[model samples]
Target chain A: MALTQEHIQQRLTEKFGDLVSNFETPYGMLSFEAPKDQNLKVLQFLYDEADLNFQFMTDLTAVNYPDKPGRELAVVYHLHNLRDNVRIRFTVYSDINSPDVFTASKLFSAANWMERETYDFFGVNFVGHENLKRILNVDEMDYFPLRKEYPLEERTRIDKDDQMFGRG
Target chain B: MTEHHQHHIKLPEGSIEKQTTTLNVGPTHPATHGVFQNIMELDGEQIVSTEQTVGYIHRAFEKLAERRPLYQITTLTDRLNYCSSPLNNMGWHLTCEKLLGVQTPKRVDYLRIIIMELSRISDHLICNSIMGVDTGAYTGFMYIMQYRELIYEIYEEICGSRLTTNIGRIGGFERNFTNTAFTKLEKFLKEYPAALRELENLFTRNRIFMERTIGTGPISAERALNYGFTGPNLRAAGVDYDVRVHSPYSSYEDFDFKVPVGKTGDSYDRFLVRNEEMWQSLSILNQAYKKVQEFKGAEAEVFHADVPEYYLPKKEDVYTKMESLIWHFKIVMGEVDMPKGEVYHSIEAGNGELGFYLVSDGGRTPFRLHFRRPSFIYYQAYPELVIGGMLSDAIVVMSSLNLIAGELDA
Candidate 1:
């Protein structure tokens, strides 16, 4: 049987029951958020559940929502159940201050580099990541460049200018 | 340090020991091809382990996308997978269309399929021929390179750029496919199969080539899935999951083509899978072209969908008409505001699933855009792939993975 959105929603609601909330079908994709602490449990359930085998990790990345205070960083995981050709969006929010989330590397090895990249840009600290220094930016880069506070380099800006950083 | 970049060792602390010799595959070496490289720890000829480092040419495209308007970001997507840039271009456009809830005409989708398949052929040709070169067969590389140029000529005819073609707009093609482009497509369809078959004979049947690649760098289907493998790499492992088939983007469902699979996912399996995919792409291209030729009268003349608000105006139209001038100016200057939506769209890029995840806040620019680059994802398994293999086999497997640095770093 093909996996439908309601089936996925029911499976999640039954398994975790309100632990996952904001169940929405954004652009025909089942999207919901799990508690930051229970991310792995949710992932494990979604994986181990024979009918809900979303084993394939399509993408892993974080979005910096500057307006949201406690939930500043939204770490989004796009998972695919290849058996049923069904896709769902699983997200967990973390505070920019703490930004600690459980790493999915243990479950999905693909999450290793992606988590590093997410750390490199958004400063979303994976609490147990094996090596979480930097992936794309220089190691000495003190600030996460993708955060909304550090706007993209512009000629009009006077504070922290390019010449000050030796980029000029 | 010339000692395999001690600065770039990404391995865990205790994994590397003192006995094995460390060899640099490349950040610039000719054999590695792209800017990314791996530091292999070899016990004589056998690779004990590898630590790979990437992002030497990091352009911060995702960060840059935060400020640019929707249409302006096409140029950024163009730089992702330069080998099959039109695929990236089309992928971005489709993402934008999905977010905007714009339905593209069937004719537009067919035209896009034609361009996309041509790009797939070009990309797979370069990769397969490069694999041949790595296996010490240089003649096959040179033999099929001209056919790749023919594919490029087709791209040139349509988009006026050989590489990094920002081919189509959000709605559809900037203009209709010209007669020259169609002529070039016909020429490619006529000549490429024979060349491809001979290229196959040169590598597939040769005993040396078979021996070198047959069991080298094999991965099981389970491990590949765990490591987020897709495209020909995953299919080479015998899982026939293709984005085109599974998701059916841009009217891919309208046509019928087989998704080729291979057992014992190795360099040879990857090579065979890519070669077969090229044949299937050719068949799709033929069907799309024929479907395009079937459009008649008013339907034939239509190119871009009737989304003037998003589609860029023709140069002549912008020059002549005042309304066209305003819309063009508005689009170019980032005055148009996109609807608030989150959309993830991926296409079957030549390498694998090249996905674009866009989140909009009903602003002039995207709040966030992430490229689910297949090169970045699948290339993570390189260390696992090269472990316990001969040092020489690492080079062939790397080329077989077809990691384009532009996409990898992005």
Candidate 2:
């Protein structure tokens, strides 16, 4: 039988039971959220299962929600099954204070740099990653640039006044 | 007491301690072709281990996208892969159209197809010729660069810019293709194939070139998939997956073409795969041009969608008409609100899958935008690829991968 979104969802719900929640089919793709600690278990199950083989890590990124107090960061994983050509998105949320998610670098080698990028931008600390330092930004950067806390433009520039640019 | 303790330090017998010298290839080497640094630990001419450092040209495009309006962000996409800027422009436009729920006409899609394939040809030409140049053959590089000049002329005729072409609008092109553009494209189509054949004869079977590239940097199919390789690189590893075939966005399903594959994912295989793809692109271009010419009288002039709120108005209409003036002002100022949703759309860029993962909250700009650049993902495996190979092989591998610094660091 060809793998469908419902089959994948059903398998996930059966394996993890109530651990996986927030099931959604946004734009005809299966998306769901898991606990931050259970990320590796979910990824391993998805990789090992014959009927639900999503081995290809298409993309890995994070979105910051400053308003959500307990869950301020969401790490999204896009996995693809080459045999079936089906894609599913898995997400895990963590608090901003102690944002530690298990690394998938051991399973998917592509996750090494992507996880480092996520850590560099959003400060999502992948616990077991071998080299979880900054990937893109300069080594001297003190703050995570992609988080919602910082403003887009530099506030320290003295040459241009805000009144001249119509901001004031 | 210290002198007595250091009196007899024993050395192991017959240990031929060899020194491995560390070399920094570039943030600006001629053969690097981009601003990227490769730190290699070398034992004589062979690389013992390698480390890569990118982001020298990083401008943080994703962060910039949050502050700019939708139309203004197209300029960012152009800089990502400047060699094939039209592809990035078209990919972003398609994503926005999906969000706006706009359906483009068949003629518009065909025109886009023609320009995209031309860009693909130009991109592959640069990659293949540069590979030749790296291997100490300058004739083929000079021979093929002239065709890229022709392709750039076609781009100029369409968008008034050659390299960083912010060519098309959200719904469609800014204007219809001129007769002069078509004439130039015709001339290109007639001449490029012979130049391509000549280029192939120079390197495909040449003994030295084959020895340099055939098994220089090899990646298996399973490993390539695990490392998130796509486009020509992945296809060269014997995986027949293509975004055009798998996802079928932007009327690619209507066209008929073959996805080429190679058994061994080596430098030579990558070169062959890209060469075969250029032929397929030419075939697609021919078909698209024929289909575009079939549109009749009034239909032929329709370049953009009918949605005035999203598409920009002409300068004359904006000056004279009332509604056009207001719409122009609103669009330029980005006062029009977008829908509340998230969408991920990808296109098969010259390098790989160039994806736009957008999250909007019905605001003037995106809440979050992530550009899934293929170069960023593929460059991750470079250190592992060149670890045990010769130093010369490292240069060849880098050229074959065709890492664009802008895309890599974006």
TM-score each candidate: 0.94, 0.95
Stretch of 10 with least lDDT, candidate 2 chain B: B1-10
- Backbone clashes counted, model 2: 0
What lDDT score is found at residue B227 in candidate 1?
A: 94
Clash pairs detected, candidate 2: none
Model no. 2, DockQ? 0.62
Query: What lDDT would each prediction earn against the true structure?
Result: 0.91, 0.91
TM-score of chain A of 1: 0.91
What digit string (tens of lDDT, one per residue) describes model 2 on residues B276-344? 999999999999988888898999897888888899998899999999999888887677988987788
Worst 10 residues of 1 chain B by lDDT: B1-10
